[model samples]
Target: MNILITGATSGIGKELALQLTSKGHKVGLMGRRTERLQELKDEIGDIAFIRTLDVTNHEKAEEVYNSLIDEMGGMDVMILNAGIGRIQMLPPWEAESKLIEVNALAFAHGCHFAMDYFRNRESGHIVGMSSMAALLAHHRAAAYTASKHFISNYMKGYRQKAKRMNADITITEIRPGYVWTEMTERAKGMFWVAPVEKAVSQMVTGIEKRKNYVYVTKRWQLLAWVAKLVPEWVWDRL
Candidate 1:
């Protein structure tokens, strides 16, 4: 399969690129760091094709995605994995808004492009990197959590739209709990932090199965159920 992954320079995106390439899939990697992309290409050999650009630059992201899709002989799947989450409040509204831009606006951009491509081809998959934060609100990172909520619902809307249109496409939302990655390296007091490899392994399996939604590390599935059951009073306490 030919795959495209945004934010492929580090963390979950990087792991997905590497693991998928090892499985003989042609992977198109997109990120801002050209040097890191080079390093990944060097490690993965010819299977790795990279386009160095930030997803926030909507025009450039769309341009590079189309070019890379053709470069990879057309993409079978596009992973809308580029996102940002900073544990800060509204005092620094810039940081909070930036989180919304990347997590929601940029995600919408990628999803729209992928949906268009899939609609034309009548076959493809769109995978979104959402978070458990979508299920529940967080105090310190209100914008981040809300942005994820947008992502979760946005993907669901796309899924429903595709179904109604009778389009042969799939939307998979990956909701991960804490994982040990550069994104979480500075986070404090995190629990049940799965190793990056372990998290990616489960993610890949879920993607392969084309599941509508998946919780990383498998154990998070239990938390997901419990999360839905919590009342407002209990949720406020947590």
Candidate 2:
């Protein structure tokens, strides 16, 4: 299958490109770092296509993605994996606003492009990188959590729209709890962190199965249920 993934410089996006291309799938990767993109292309060899662009630049991103789709003949799957996160200290609006831009607006850009492509073809898959934070609000990172919530709901809305239009499209929202990637490597007080490979393996399975929503590592499903079951004040205490 032809697959295009945004934010492929590192972490889950990079690993997914590696694993998928190693398995003989044609993969297209977009990232801001040219050197990193080149390195990934060298590592993955001929099956990989590399384009350097910031996902937040919606117009350029669309052009690059459309070129990738054309180069690969067509895209079977598109993964909107570009995101940013940080623990706010004070005067949080700056970080919060950036988070919303990268995590939410960038995501919408990719989703719009993919939806248009898929709708015209009548068959395709879109996989979004939401987080378990979508299920609960985080005190230190409210914007990050809120952005993920936006992603979850946005994907669900597309799911419903596709159904209404009788389009043969799949919307898969991947809500990962904690994966040990560069994004979380410096994070303190982390819990239940799964290895990148472990998380990606499960994520790939869910994508292949075209699941509407899935928690990485499976065990996170328990946490999600508990999060919903617990009362607000009780949750705050934990």
C-alpha positional error of residue 26 in candidate 2 after TM-score superposition, expressed in Å: 0.5
The C-alpha stretches of model 2 lying farther than 4 A from their native spots are 87-91
C-alpha-based local distance difference test score of model 1: 0.92
Per-residue lDDT tens digits for candidate 2, residues 1-238, read 9999999999999999988887789999989899999999999988899899888888888889989888887899999999988845646787788889999999988998899999999999999999999998878778889999999999999999888765799999999989999989989988999999999989888988889988988999999989889899986876
Give the range where candidate 2 is weakest over 10 consecutive residues by summed lDDT: 86-95
Model 1 C-alpha lDDT per residue in residues 119-225, reported as the tens digit of each score: 98989999999999999887877888899999999999999998976578999999999999998999998999999999999999999999999899788889999
